[model samples]
Target: MALAGQPNVGKSTVFNLLTGLSQHVGNWPGKTVERKEGTYSHNGISVDIVDLPGTYSLTANSAEEVIARDHIIKERPDVVVAVIDASSMERNLYLVAELLSLQTPVIVAVNMMDVADQQGLKIEPEVLEAALGVPVVPMTATNNRGIRELVEAVDELTRDEATYEPKRPEIREDHRAVLEELEHLVAAHVPQPYPSDWVSLKLLEGDDEIMRMMEDRLPQETWEQVHEILKEHEDAVLAVASGRYDWVGRMTRAALVRPGVGQITLTERLDRWATHPLWGLLVLAGILGLVFLLTYSLGAPLQGLLETYVIEASARLAASALAGGPSWLTSLIVDGIIGGAGMVVTFIPILIIFFAMMGLLEDVGYMSRAGYVMDRFMHLMGLHGKSFLPLFLGFGCSVPAVMGTRVIDSRAGRLLTTMLVPLVPCTARMVVLAFITPIFFGAAAPLVAWSLVGLNLLVLAVAGVVINRIAFGGERAAFIMELPLYHKPNWQTIGILIWQRSLAFFKRAGTVILVVSVVLWGLSALPTGDIETSFLAGAGRLLAPLGALMGLSWQMMVALLTSFVAKENAIASLGVLYGAGSEAGLAETLPTIMSPAAALSFLVVQMLFIPCVATVVSIFNETKSWRWTLFNVLFLLLVSFGIGILVYQVANVVS
Candidate 1:
């Protein structure tokens, strides 16, 4: 069985409830759209379910539509279950009309009945089933209301071998005449398995893919006749679409009872401001500001407490426990393993706050509005509106941001968005900035940090235009995203989201961070037991000239070099280089060793430097192009250094 629906119709919720933990995700064959399949046992009968991409229609205007349409046509699943939103039956039935045209066995699963009832809309499933000639199961998928009936309907349809013919919507008489002629022609020319009537309708609708296929298969004279007929009835496309809507309107009137016609709900009223051009931006800024304020005000204190009472005390105990062990072994365990990894672990409080707030925004459906408001801005940077969500996520982490590019249908759009994501100044980089800013600017730290964020966005915008001009040259794809209704956030869902993200972060800390920290420790603690003479310091010396250009000292250069492993490692390197035991100690020691200009330059460099190792790997994984990955690293290095030098020069002159 295959499940299909429009976006935000609770299709995924149903899929999760049925599949549980017995599912796998992968890319569709030769497409970036994700394919989800799972097996479950219902009524002692095992069934396999495939979740198709959520699209508004089956038109071949986007890659997702093409993939979904082809899967249903080529795979020929046993039953196609169309999930419809009960609150918006007319809009949801558009896809159902297309599905019926394919002559495939379909069962209408009316989801979100509770939401519909709350909206004062009464639906009659028996009437709907009689009208559409398919089994209609009313369900509130979120609460698992009618899932049993849905499954029984599926089982009954699959078990019965009777010939099932779907009732398709009727088009206008003129359109119907043209479709009949074209259908006869297509049936004679096209092979079996290609539904002739569907192809005929698609041809009338001016589907480029179908036109290409027909042109490839049909004889020249036959093709010329088909082209002449299509050219003669150019308005048939709109006519056919209007006819489907008419049929849906009739069906909805027959089966649905609305308490008030054209009543604007609370969601619509709020969306007016949330999606406005100017007001929406203000709202977004306020939300983002609140998120950061909450993260810093709440998380900073907890982080300091952990560092002081937990990590530091534990380190002292470990040192005391390892006093009689070999000297190198003690240094490795205390400084290399614990110190290196613990530095990263300390920031979990802030990350948790960030992730939790982001999860709340996502759960409440405002994130989609953020994307909607930013669509025009994205177009200015040669991106679609849908690209904004992943980029917004970059402020939290780059790994998932890069992975989120899968939602973009255009390959060029995905690549462009991926390249700019690293420039968004992730939470780890924010930690480094948070650590350094106060030491240099005192009470003006927040303003300076805000300035750095503004600079990052500016640089990202400019880089986007430049990259789009040089690498991506094509028509900008259209972005149509569904804005879900806002509801009270489910704390359980938000907690699960936070737990999953935190788990991924901790795993990285344990694996990549632990190994890199050990290796860096070895490089800094080699022969003679002096960091100045160590291999890592020697490597930093080689880059001293470049660092000098940016007013950065050799020690700062080493710290920046270590940051490539993980952004938090930059702070760890600072502690090891300056012999400062904690972040507070480094904050005090940093100002005395470097001028204010140089300190500011160091922070700028950290903000714009190459992404950490984990993000680099994610970029490569998403793009599968070593060339683009290497280009991002090299391009960012130049940009970071250039910006750092400019800031240093300006700051020196002002001072």
Candidate 2:
């Protein structure tokens, strides 16, 4: 089952009600529109449902709608429950009609009945059923009304195959000729029992998917005749587009009853304040202040707690193992891997807490406001208004935000955002803050962490200006966003989301991380334990010239290399190299590298360095090319190291 409807209709609520699932639902697949799946039981049978993105029609215009329509047309779900907003039948019915034409037995779940009634509009389910010739159930999914009726309808449609008479779009006389020709050819061959007129209309419209289906089956002469009809009009595709909307408008006027005045849209009032220049600016600042406070106040303690566990356990295990086991194996498992990997994994809960809160805000529709409020700032950075989401979320984790670029429209903006988002310090960088920032600056650790983040964001802003001047060479992409109405988030929904995200991290630790930890254990233990001559040590020695500038020794250089595998590995590499650098222990060795200025420069280098292997792998997958992956890796490495060198030289000269 897939919940298909127009954007901002009650589709998400219906999915929440039907599947008893709360996940981030958006308009694009893999971007804002990552495909979400959940399962529920009806009549003792578990049925799996996929929530396809909200698309306006089955025309396959945008990437999101195309993904949705392709899945339905190909996967052929057991049953599709089309959640239609009763209040906006005209726009909503366009999608419903397209689905009906697929011959996919669909039960129309007329959602937002509460809104319809409040607006003094009546939608009779029987009338809707009679009109569409399929089951129509009106319900408020949010309040759990008519849910039983919807489930029963889905059950019947999936089990019993009853062919319903679906109305095909009527065409004008000019297009009627093209339809007749298309109808004559597809009538006998196609298996799906969709109406002939619908198939004809699709062919006349030059709907590529359906026409390709016909071309593969139809005789050459038949298509030649169809092609002749298409070529005859100056812009034949427009004919079909106009005809369908015209037909949809006629059906909507007949089926839906609405007042001369629309009901008071709740979002309007909120929008006025949320988008107001002065009030909106303050609101955005408050949200940012709170988010910053959480990162430091709430997350710092948890990071400290997790770090304590890592340090104490590593010390005790190392002591006990040395008494009974081989020194090398014990050192590898206890000091090299556990001490290293554990340091990183300890921060997993804190990262999860941050992600969960961010996810909840996004689900309840508050996150978009961040983009809304940050439009002016984005403009100054030479980006469109909506670029803020990717930039902001990049601070949490660049992987999702990089993927989030699908929501951005322009090639230039997307590329610019993709390149610069990585500069924003991620949750992995949080380990650096909790571990080193305090050691370097004490009470000012949080402030330093935030300032570095702010500085990186500033760097990104300057880079954006350079990019626009060099690569984009045009105005920022057109920026418009649909701000959904605010509502109370369902926590049970948020908890499931947190479980999925955090458990994913834990699973990594148990499987991929565990294996890597073992491999890292072997790498760090073998050849030699000498800080200057081990394999990593040799590798670090090559970076000595670069390291001297940032005030980091080759040992620190090795830790920087380890950061690529995992941020925690950097800390672990250090425990083997440096002491109780406990969870609360300041990154005690950083100050020894050089002056405080060098320490700050060292932090900046770490902040902007290349992402982990997982992020690199994701980039490869997103680009579908290894060359691009290598390019990103080398570019960031050069950029990060270059900044470090520059900072060191400048600081030394000033001193």
Candidate 3:
């Protein structure tokens, strides 16, 4: 079975509810669009369900649309569940209308029925089912309601097969002959798995994917005839959409009852403040401050406990167990892997808290309001609010932020946004700031942390404007994003998101951080047991002059360099260099070695440093150009060190 829906229609919630931890997530074949597949057992029958990308239509306007359309036509699933918002049936039924024409079994899953009821809208499932000639299951996916009935509906369709005979939409009456004529012209050349009638409709509607395919396959005469017909009825696209809307209108008219004239929804009442032009920005800023505040207040204590009990104890035990072994072996186990990677792992609690808070915001639908409020600011950089969505993802990880640029329709806007995404201070960088800032700044750490984040965004805005003017010639795109209704957040959804993200972090720590730590430790231990006389020391001394400009010693400089491999590696490298196996010891040691002015400069540079290796590779893959990737790295490098030197010099004078 396949799950299909427009964005924010509870499709993901339904998928999660059905699959739980059984799902696998990765990119689509040869595309950055995410693919989710999982198994669900219904009444002793195991069904493999693939969740297609959320798209407004099946037209090939974007990668998501192409992926979803190809999956249904080529890798046909047993059945496709068309999930739609029950409260906004008129808007969502268009996707359903498109799915019905695919000749595949489609079950209309009317999700968010509770939201519909809250708005005083009533929808009759039986009436909708009778009108559309397909199975219709009303559900509230967040509440886990009607899932059994939905599953049973799918089972019935698979067993009987005749229950899915849908009343598909037709072309407008005036253009019916044009569609039939084109169908006859290209029928013989239509590719495999692509229905002749569907191809004809797509050709008439000027669907880019179908037009290109038919253009290549059809004979010259047939192609010319099809093109001529399409040229003559250039308004056929409008006609086709009009037909779908007509079908949706009839079905909705028969099944849906509207509320009173003056009825107001909970979403509207909330949006008054959440989406206000002036107040919305303040709300967004306060919410961000609260998130960071909670991170320190709630997560910091737990992080300290792990460092004191878990990491420190593990390092001590490993040293004791290996004391009788080779001295080098003992140091490698105690100081290299455990001291470095183990220390980095202590910040897992902080990341968990941050991820959970972000998940809660997304689940409750405040993210869109943030984006809506930032739309004007984005316009200043020659982009729209849609670009902000991916940039927001950068706070968690730059890899997804770079990948999320696929949502933007304009290529130039996407590329410009990609350049600025690296500056968003991901959780890895945030963890480093969280750990080190408190050591030097003490109680004012959160204030300084917020300032660093704000500085990065300020740099990002300036960079966006500069890049947009120089490379992209300052083109702007307009967008319309639907704000989902604010509802009680589902803990299960937030829990699953936190689990997935935290698991990813731990996996990276175990692999990348582990390897880098051991390698750096070897460099520091070689030729002598003392790090001061080892290979790593020799290398850091080579760059000591540049470090002096930034008011950082050789050790701090080495940590910044190591961050390119992975942002968390900076902390791991620092632990190994300073030989502090516990956060307590490292925290004490950092303040004594560096003055407040230099420490502030170091934090500024760390926040603006080149993104980790994974994010760099993603940038290259997304842009498909080494030129753009190299430019992004060099641009950030210059900006980071330039600002670092200026900050250090000015603060050194002030202090």
Candidate 4:
């Protein structure tokens, strides 16, 4: 079945419920232009469902609309489950009317009924079904309510047992000749009792896609008449514009029933406090604070345990290998491989903590509220309210954040938003941020990390304003976003999600970071077998002069350079430079790296530079251009260095 509906009308949610799948659950899919299908069994009959991209109309003026329309006409599904939000009945019916023009068998699922009931909005399913000449089933896809009824309804409609009788309302008398031919000639070809007036209505809308579909099939004379008919209709959009709204009004007027003085529901009362600016900010802050507290503190102990065990195991394994292997081979296998693996493995704690917190917020629905709070600001940033999901994901990693751009409807908005995503100090930033800044700042790590995040945001805001002025160059636009009603997070879901994210962390540890770490270790190991004398050290000293521009010593410069490849390497490189397990000589080892200003500068540089390989790949995927990718890398690097230099120079000059 083709899942057709307006944007954010619970289409994806229904897809998730019916197919037992979750696909970012946004209104749109990302850059990949393809239709996705899933199959399931219902009432002992195998049912296949196609989740088409959401579209407001089938006029084919826009690329997305063309894609949505082409799929429905070309790859005809057994049934068209026209999912509609019960609350937004008037606006949604336009697409239903368009679908009916194709004479496709439709099963209207009035989804999000739970939400509608809570909002005190009631819909007459029978009256709606009769008006549209289709069966309507009131559904709550979340609780899986009325799903069976919807499926059965679709089954009966597509079986051809329940024939569709077109209800074409009155049309102007002048348009009758061409419309009459569409009814007779087109009807002979289409072989369905498709409405004469609805087809005529489409002709008036100047729907090129439908026109093109019928173009080559009909005779040459029919094509001539079709053009004449379109010309006669003159402004079809204007004609359909008048007709659709009036039709909607009539349908709802007859069918809709409203209760007088309906009491305020739970959602309305809670919405008062929830949407309050001050209280909402506080609530958001408190929730974020709890997330912060949990990420490091909860993950720290687990990290320590993992580190200790790995270190001991490596020591034992290295000593045991010395009996059989060559010295350098032993060193490569033992110190390089084991040490590299250990560092990333230790991050498992952080990963679990991060994903668990994110999943709870998203699964419980506060993520939507966070977006709600940020929406007005995002509009000013030239992005839609929906842009927050990707930005929020950016806090963890830029890959998913950039991937999240699929939900955005406008390419300009998506490109700008994707460009800005990397600038945010993600959780990957946290690995480097938490490790080094704490050396001098101590309890101020969170404060400094947050400050780096603030700086990123400040840059993003300034960049947005400038980009909007130059690149976007238009009036502010708004999005239709429904912040789902909040509920307490589920532990079982959170647990599974925590494991899901932790698995990703382990995969990185085993593959990406592990290989990079070994390479880093090898880079530090080669060229006279001395870090200060290695090729990297020569590269480090080149950076040291520029590092002095940021008030950093040679050692800190070396670490920062390594960080360009990956942020976590900044920490591991420092661990190598200062001697990881040498608390006995803390003063001698640590003080040599540089002063507080340099340390802070180092953190700033690492935080703002290009994200991991995954993020860069994502940028490439979204932009589909290498020039933009280079600009992102270099732009962020420039931002990092400029901020670092100015910060250190100011601090030094002040002192």
Model 4 C-alpha lDDT per residue in residues 1-655, reported as the tens digit of each score: 7888888888877887777752323333454655667776776777777787788977776767767766666666677888988877778887777776664677788998877776677788888778877778899887889887877787777677457664533344444455566556565444223344555556556766556656766788877877776776676466556555667778778666655545755666666766677777677778778876887688778777887887657757776968577766666666666665555666667666777778888887777777777667787777776677787667766665787788778888888888889877776577667666666777887898778778888888877777767778855676566868777778999999888756754664357555765676677778677887888888888777788898877777787767654566666677667775443354345656577787777777777776766567668878998988888888778888998999888877876
CA-only RMSD, every prediction: 12.1, 13.6, 13.8, 12.2
The residue ranges of model 1 lying beyond 4 angstroms of the native Cα positions read 1-243, 246-262, 404-409, 579-593
Assess candidate 1 and give its lDDT.
0.88
Provide the lowest-lDDT 10-residue window in model 3.
Answer: 504-513
Give the C-alpha miss distance for residue 562 in model 3, angstroms.
4.2
Q: Pick the candidate with the highest TM-score.
A: 1
Query: All candidates' TM-scores?
Result: 0.67, 0.61, 0.60, 0.64
If candidate 2 were superposed on the true structure by all CA atoms, what would the RMSD be?
13.6
lDDT per residue as tens, model 3, 541-634: 8879999997798989888877876687788778867888766888888887899999999999999999976678779878999999999999
Write one digit per residue (lDDT tens) for candidate 2, span 486-510: 9889898888888876675455443
Task: Rank by lDDT, highest first.
Answer: 1, 3, 2, 4
Q: Point out the worst 10-residue segment of candidate 1 by lDDT.
A: 159-168
* Deviating ranges (above 4 Å) for candidate 2: 1-118, 121-229, 232-263, 275-285, 368-391, 397-421, 434-449, 462-483, 568-593, 621-624
Q: What is the lDDT of residue 66 in candidate 1?
A: 92
Give the CA lDDT, 0 to 100, for residue 324 in model 3: 86
Each candidate's clash count:
0, 3, 0, 2
| Alpha-carbon lDDT, every model | 0.88, 0.72, 0.87, 0.72
